[model samples]
Each structure stands twice: as structure tokens, then as C-alpha cells.
Target chain A: MTASRENSSSFRNHTLTVLAIVLLFLFLWWADGSMAEDLGLSFLPEGLNGYEVQILNLVAVYGILAISLNIIYGFTGMFSLGHAGFMAIGAYVSALCVLTPDQKEMMWIIDEILPSLAALHTPFWFSVILGGLVATVFALLIGIPVLRLGGDYLGIATLGFSEIIRVLIVNATPITNGSLGIKGIPCHTDLFTSFIWLLVVVFCTVRLLSSNFGNVLKAVRDDEIAAQVMGINVFHTKLFSFCLGAFLAGVGGALLGNLLTTIDPKMFTFLLTYNILMIVVAGGLGSISGSIIGSVIITVLLEWLRVVEEPLNLGFVEIPGIPGMRMVVFSVCLLVIILYRREGIMGMREITWDGIAAFLSRFGRKKENRA
Target chain B: MSLELFLQHFFNALTLGSLYGLIAIGYTMVYGILRLINFAHGDILMLGAYFVFYGTTLFCLPWPVAVVVAILGSAGLGVLMDKIAYRPLRDAPRISALISAIAVSFFLESLAVVVFTGLPRPVHQPEWLVSIITIGGARLMPLTLLVPGVTAILVAALLYVVYHTKPGLAMQAISKDIETTRMLGVSVDKIIALAFAIGSALAAASGIMWALRYPQINPYMGVFPGFKAFIAAVFGGIGSIQGAVIGGLMLGFIEIMAVAFFPELSGYRDAFAFILLVVVLLVKPTGLFGEKQKEKI
Candidate 1:
């Protein structure tokens, strides 16, 4: 009887959680459309430009990317600097797949379009999934050879792969449009779409992390040899984590490309990967919620930090913007974080409901005492 | 290839190899002691070049004096970077140091961008180094000969210091076992600083030579060469100095010869070194000259 009661309560809790999330999402969807004034007041302030909204969307995308990276680098103990490359594959593939033939014709002015790819077109959702799949395939191919090498060697090899991928994208003129890049990708990404994708990705990641496979992954991360002795196939587990990370990275890339309405070889440089690395490291390596929080903080701060990179005007004085100052500040922050707060803001802990409830109760007791 | 073309490619490869080798020594030396890839080593090379540029133009120093200034400045910066960015993290996880190194790299590059502006400054070549010299049927610049000659001397000097000197023995011991070296009476920090100083001095020499060869200086210029030199160092063996030179030379030859033979593949030239790196990692992770040590389980 107690078991049945516990099961029903658990079901009720799940339903309540789902209802709360759905309500939140519904509010966002409505605010995004007809309730622009309300959104401007509550979600974002009035007088904010389109660029701010775009930055907000990027935070969602980066959240998903960071969590995915956490699976490989955090949970699986593989240091990969190739997230940008996978994202590039996703970006290029999705962009190419979704662009109209007319748009392709306009964009590929530097070289003739490959006849096979010219006529190809898929819907936005399909293109995104296809991009993820393509990235997964590439990850598998690259992973087979380089995954055995641990630590810094893996980092360099993956970095090399990303560079090679970038080179290929630049040189394969017929397919990627060379340096001109593809423009006019349909903008299908927005707050709601990206939030939904982030939810799905985070849900999947959480489920995967809680599963037996996730345990195996953490085992390998803590000690590969010990995990192997415990009968885990270390290689296969790592490969799985890598492919999953690549898949989500691809999806994030697709969202970024569609939102920006352009895809370019230059967009997927090591600098892009570096930014993601900063997010992962700052978010606390192994925490899922930390990834989300880190993504939001870093992405917004990066955009906000543009103030330093732009000229400031006062009533009586003007201070010219110093280029690269934004990055200088960012690197300093990263250095500080690495040196002092290496475990990051969240460490390996997640934000739990019980912790929140206990804090609320404690606040209520404090008010009672004051009274 | 004709004899003239062959010789031309050979000399070009030698010059390129020497620069790569010189830069790789910095990487290998740091990696040897710390097991950390000094990503900022490339930016140090850039700073070295910039130091020389300013010394000559802004300060009106002679070229030789400017070179000395560049080397000293680079060495000081290298030691400072170690003390500030890396020394604190000596007891931290290796990944932290790697990240710190990357941060240093970004910091230096961004600092350069702010101070030097984004424009690529034209390096004024000393007239003595710019004159074309002929060897048999091949024509070359005198700097080409000087680069390899300087590289050889530097490598020999480095080898002597590493093998015959007391600090050199300390470096070898630290690389083998850091804690044990610390347990011994050696000042680990000083030895590490010395490694940084020597490595940066070599990097400065290469950077000056590279500027002489290329004649243009930009804040972001050292990135590609730095990566390629790291690849060269790895190909030779991370801890082996001689291996770095051989690997640098081989990479230089492959890069030049591949482009020379098939001009169309020039677009893929940058990819070549990375491909070589991946292959080397896969086939021989220890590299050609690297001694394989059993992992202490």
C-alpha cells in the first residue's frame, strides 16, 4: 500500500513538473508572437534591439552545445577541441540542405555548384537532423583513429581534425561555395524553437547520464583502466559519448546557421571552439545544469562585453573603443576561473528541488523569528 | 624536377625547416619539463618579431642590437608568462595548465591587436640580409643561408646546454619526475624559468628570421607557423630536441615539395601538416625520436 502511494505521489510530481514547464514554454511562445509588449517588459526590457534577441537565442543554442560537450569531456574524460568542426559540418550541411536552388545559385558565384547537391533540398527540421547525423558520422570516422590517445594528444589530434575540416570546407569550392559561403538560409531558429531543442537535448542527456551507460562513462572518466577491469568496453563507451556530443553540436550549429541566415568556412574556426571551451570549463565540467547556467552567463556577458569594444560617449568626453579589449577581459576571466575557482560555480552538483524547498522553508522560519 | 628547381626547393625547404625547428625547440623544451604545450610560444614569436620591428623603427637601434633586444625581450616575457600564468598552476591538473597556456596565447594575441592595431606592418629587411646569392645553378637570398646556419648553431648550443650543463640535468630530471626533482635540492621554479628563457630566445631568433623571409608582420601571424612547428615537434618527438629539427625539416620538405610538384594541391597545403600529425599519432604515438615510457599504472 505504501509502495502504491509512493508511486502515485511520484507520478503526481512528474505531472506537476511537466505542467509547469509546459506553462512556461506556452508563455514564451505567446510572448514571442502576440505579446511583444509584455515580453519587452518581463522577459526583456523595452528599447532592446533585434541583436539582443539574437544573443538570447544564441544562449539557448550554446546551452545545448555545452551540455553535449559535457558528456564527452566531463562525463567520458575525453578532451575534444573539435566541437566547432562538427558544428561546421552541421551548419554547412543543414544550410545547403535547406537553401532554395535559386539561393544556392546566387551564393555559389565563385564556382559552379555540384550538380548532385544543387537540386537537393529538405525541410528545416529534416535538414537539422540530417546535419546532426552527418556530424555523428564524421565524429565516428575521426574518433576511430584518435580516441585511443588520451589527454593532450587527443586535444591536438581533434584540433587537427577541426583544422582539416575547415580547410576542406574552404577548398571544396563546388560544394561549400568556397570562401563566399552560403547566404539566405531560411531563419527557422527563434526562442521557442531553440528552447524546445534545448529541452529535448537536455532531457536526452540527463536520461543518458542516469542510465547504466552513463555510469560506465563516468567509470571510464574516473579511471579508464579500472573501468576496463570492471568489464566496460572503454573504447566503445568513449566513442558513443563523442558521437553524442558531435550530434548535439551539429544541431546547435544548424540553429546558429539558420538564425544567422548565413554559413561560412571562417565561422567555424578554433576561436569558436575556444569560446565553447570557456563555457564548458566555467560551467563546472561535469554538471548538466551548470552547463545551462554557464552558457547563459557567458553568452550574455560576451555580448554585453561588446560595450568595451565599442566607443563610449559621455556628455563631455569620448573614449574610443579598443578592439580586442573584449577578448582581453574574457581571457583574464578564464585565467582567474582556472586558477581560483577551478571547480567553477556549480562544481559537480546540480540544482535540486529539495535544496530549493529547504531554502524557502528556512527563509520562512527567518521571517517568523523576526516577527 | 630540374637540378636548379630541385636545389631551389631544397634551399627553400631548409630555410623553412630551420624556422619551424627553431620554434619547435621552444615547444619541446617546455613540454619536456612541464608536459604542457605552450600555446603562447607562437605569440611569443610574434612579440619577438614586433620587438625587433619597434627597436629598429621606433628606437632607431641597429639591426644586430635590435635582434639582441628582441631575444632578451622575448626571454623576459616567456619567464614572466611562466611565473604569472603557469607557476601558480604547477600543482593543479595538467588540463588547467593547458588551458592557462591557451589563455596566455589569447591574451598575447589580443594585447598585440590592441597595441599594434590590426594592420600588417611591413618589416624592413636589412640590406645585407636581402641580397640574392647564387649557389651553382640556384639563386637564393643570403637570409636563407643565414637562417639554417643560425638554426644549426642554436641547436648545437641547445644540445650542449641540455646535455653538459647542470640546469640541463635538472630539466631532464624534472621531466622524468617533477616531485622527485623537487624533493632533491633543486629550485624547480628557477629551472622552469630557465627553460622558458632559453626556449623564448630560440623562438625570438626564428621569429626575426621569419620576418626577414616574409617581410610582413601582423599580430595574428604566428598562429599558423606555431601550430605547424608544434606538429613538427610532435613528429620528431616532444621531448627530443634533435627529433624536433628532423621533424621540422621533413615537414618543411613535404610541404614545399608537395606544392612544388602539384601546384593545384596548394590550397590543401595547411591541411598537410595536420594530416601528418594525425597519422603520426595513430601510427607512432611516441613519435620517431620519442622514447616510449611505460605508463605507471
Candidate 2:
């Protein structure tokens, strides 16, 4: 193909991909709405109730979070266990921002609310962005020091920072309402808001990964010393990715708080980060598409596994619920996957239009041969 | 503060430091050989406590016998963890092993929750162990003094093994270069398993002591102390046993003293360790006893 013709064809492919994604989103939205209402949609998958819709919202939020973590841990090769801390910051800041004055007063029971915070309230969208920005600032401050360390040291430091943040949030009652946590915040995150944010995050992350900056990060992940020798300002690149990841994690947290309509210091524990880490690792490190795929699969899998934890009544007998069985199963799955398929499902490969086209063409050729 | 109060704080710091040091040694040894952060090291500590809990409560064993059983059981579990989770990934990318370590950690924690439940349970100490003693107008439990004494003894034993024994030499050689050690016909796997056994045995000892001191045992009890111990290991310089001990002591002192000085910020005591870590890492990443790692081109 000529250069111009190739460019035009690629542009068309891009448009088609975007349109397809949009259509998928619309279909999902319609289906979700119907499921929530228990309206007739016999041809579709079983409709989700209000509770299920909430779970689906969590999936989208986690999808954004998992992808953002992928940028830091997967792409940049920084093993951070501090994403929860960033999420906590976003959750509290955004939750506080959107809370009405009365709600703030009602929530801050332990101590008198700070006057400045008491007076301030941002729109939901603005609060979410602000939450992300604040988290980015914290990440930048933290990354400057911790990013210099390699491997497990970085993970420890970040994990420690997260614990510190949680502790601080518990103690800083004036601003965060201490450990009592903010309750009854406006529920602004629906399927539309969450899906839109995921789309934006996925788009930007893909673009960034394709850029020179992304290449530098991949190089850093592959071999830090070589990247350093190749004149990459390794620390700056790492810090940038770390901060960006923190920003998205912050946004995800904000959405999560809104979705749950509550926020607490205990909610953003190390386990929260562990879950996100599981998603990133299981999705395939350094793959954005893998993060999304992993996020949805793990999210659904986790929810589905709740069955083993709940009491079951069969005609023959009744099985008692085992409270921790779900986690046992999940952890076993993680161990098996890591041991056997360390690269996870994607193995750093994104599902691209060209690849899909090539795969389909090969299938078509096989069918033609059979005919 | 009065002299008695100061002394009390000093004793508190010592006991806490000793526990940290004991746990840090395990992390130091594992990191020394495998260069993989055994995230499950803390869980092993929890297992030690649980094992004793079961031994004493269910089997009606004496405290000392229960303690020994806990240590030995924990060592066995540690070796098993190495065989099942870590040994296979020895040649894979470092991160894969690290992730596997995390999986093992999560698996152990969840399994603990399954078997033991998540509720915090009290571990009973013998009356003599909890007996209060007064020295220089400062009141202290015998357990307080015993913890540090036990830690010191264990450290000495570890030093003796690392410095004088054949297995110790093998451990050192393996840590220096696993491939070369293998080439030299040393049983690298055995040495690595030995490291886990010793490391986990220490974790068990400390866990039992921790249970006695705190009187509460839970599935997640190991998480925070485990993290703090890792910090201690890093602060002292990873891969250096002596460094881990020194680091543990220093962290204990910092945590105790910070809370002592600022009663208002007592809630932020955990934050102090991390702040210290970031400062040490930024100023000197190798830690106090750690040699700087040089990557060859």
C-alpha cells in the first residue's frame, strides 16, 4: 500500500474501533439498566439486580485502578504496594469535597471540623479531579525518595507509606473524621460515569505507552541499568510513571467512594492494594489490555467465588458457610497462575485491531481450505 | 519524665526491638540467599504462634514443649513453602518469585483465617513468665527481660552457625553466587531450605514471645510486625544478619521514643518507622551493613 493509502486505512480502522467500543458501551448500559429493573431481555445474559449493578460499577472502578497500577508496576517495573494509600487520599479528599456542610458536620463527630474545609465543597467531577491531583502530589513527594530504591525495597517503602497514610487518616479527625470515616456521601458514580472514566484512562494509557515516554518505561522495566546507560534519566521517568499511576488510582478511589457512598480508613488497607496487584499480575504485567481483562475476570471471579463462602441448601443436605474459603480459593488461583503462567493472560501483548484482523483472516483461510 | 518512667520506656524499647530483630534475621537470611523478599516470612511468624496455640490448648502440652513444637513446626512449614512456592521459580525472573512469595503469603493468611478464624484469640502465658519485677524503681514483666535475652541467645546461635559451620559457609557461598555455588557441587537447594528453616524457626520463637507479650493472636497479627521487621532488616542493611539486629533495635528505640516524646502523635508511631526508612533509603540505599549492589554491563 502507498503511504497515504496506508494512513487512510489505519485511520479508518481506528474510527471503526472507536465506534465499536462506543456501541459496546451503549449496549452494556442498556442491558445493565434493564437488568437493574428486571425488565424483559430474554435474549441477553441474566439481568443484574441493583446489587449486581453496584458490583459491575466496582469492576469498572477496579479496571481503571488495575490499568493505572499496570503503568507503574507492569510497564515501569516499579513494584509499588502504596496504591491503596493513593486511593485512600482520593477517596477521602473527594468524599469530603462533595459532602454537604450538614453532612460534614454530622460526620466529623470526634472533633470540630476545620473552618476552611467546612466551607469548601466542589462539584462531583471537580472533586474527583482534585482528588486525583492531590494524590499525584503525594505520589510525587513519595516517589522522589522511594523510586530511587530497587525492587522489594520500593514495595516495602510504598507499603509503609500507605500504612502511614491510613494511620494518619485515623488520627487526623478534624479533616478525615478519623477512623469513624465519612458516611452518606453523594453517590455520583454510576455505570455512565465509571465507564466514561475507564474509557478515558484506557485511551490515555494506551497513547502514553505508545509514546517515547512509554518506550523509556518499558526499557526501564526490561533492564534499569541498560536504560540508565542509554542516557535515560531513570529516576525522573520512574517518578513520572509513579505519580501518574497514583493520579489514576486516586481517581479510581474517588469513584469507588462515590459508588459505595461511604469512605473509611479501614477500607483502603494493604489488602486493597494486594487485590489490585493481583489483578495487574494476573492480567499480565506491562499490558493495558491485560489489566482490563484481568480486572473484569478477577472481579467477576471474586464475586462468583462468594458462593463457596455462603451456606448452600441442597435437597439432600445443607452445607455450612465457610467465611474465609473465598479468599483461600482466590489465593490458590493466584499461586497456580503465577507458578504456571507467570506472564498472565496477555503477556505484555495488547489486543489491537491489526492483530484481531490477522487472526480473523487466518481463521477465514482455514475455513476456505476446508470448503 | 522520672528516671523510673525513662527506664520503663527503655525496657519497652528493648523488648520491642528484640522481637523485631528476631523477625528481621529471618528476612535477612532469605534475602541473602534468594534475593527474593519472602513476603510470607511474617505469616510464618503467625503460624508459629498458632502452632503453639494449638499445641498447648488442644494437645495439653507444657508451655516449653509447646514452644519447641511451634518452632519446629514453623521451620517445617518454612521449608515446605520454599519447596512448593519458591524452589520451582528459582531460575525465573526475580519478580515472578516475588509474586509467588506474595501468593504464598496470601494463601497462608487466608488458610489461617480458614482454620483459625479471623477473630483475635488470647495466648495464655505462665504466671511466672508474666510476673512483675521491680528494678531501680521501674516495674517490668519477666517476659520483657526474657524476650530480649532469648533474642540475644538466638542471635548468638545464628552468628555461630553462619561463621563456624559448614552449612554456614555454604549459605554464604550460595548468597554470593548461587550458580557458582552449584558449580562448586554444594547442595544449593539444601542450603536455601536450611536458611528458610532457621529463619522461620526464629520467626516462631519471636511469634510465641509476641503472643505472650501481647496476649492476642490473630490471623492478621503478623502483617504489621512483619512489615516493621522487614523495615528493620532494610534499615540495618538487607542480607546482613547483624545489620538486621541493629536495625531492629534502632527501630524499636525510634518507635518507643517517638511515642514517648509526643503522646499527642502516638497514633502516628507506625508512620515514624516508614519516615525513617525513606530517609535512610534516600541518604544511603544500601542500609547500615548492606554493600551496594553493582550491576554489571
Give the Cα RMSD of candidate 1.
2.3
Cα displacement (Å) at residue B205, model 1: 1.3
Q: For candidate 1, write residues A210-320 as lDDT tens digits.
A: 898889999999999999999999999999899999999999899899989988889998888888889988999899989999999999888889999899999699999
TM-scores, in order shown?
A: 0.96, 0.97
Q: For candidate 2, write residues A280-345 as lDDT tens digits.
A: 989999888899899999999999999999999997999999999999999999999999999999
Model 1: per-residue Cα lDDT over B1-297, one tens digit each: 899989999999999998999999999999988999999999999999999999999999998899999999999999999999999999888888998888888889888998998799999987888788889889988988989999999999999999999999999999999999999989999999999999999998999999999999999888889999999999999999999999999999999999999999999999999999999988998889998978778
Q: In the order shown, what is each candidate's alpha-carbon RMSD? A: 2.3, 2.0
lDDT of 2 at A285: 91
At residue B211, give the lDDT of candidate 2: 92
DockQ, each predicted model: 0.84, 0.84
Clashing residue pairs in candidate 1 (N, C-alpha, C atoms within 3 angstroms): none
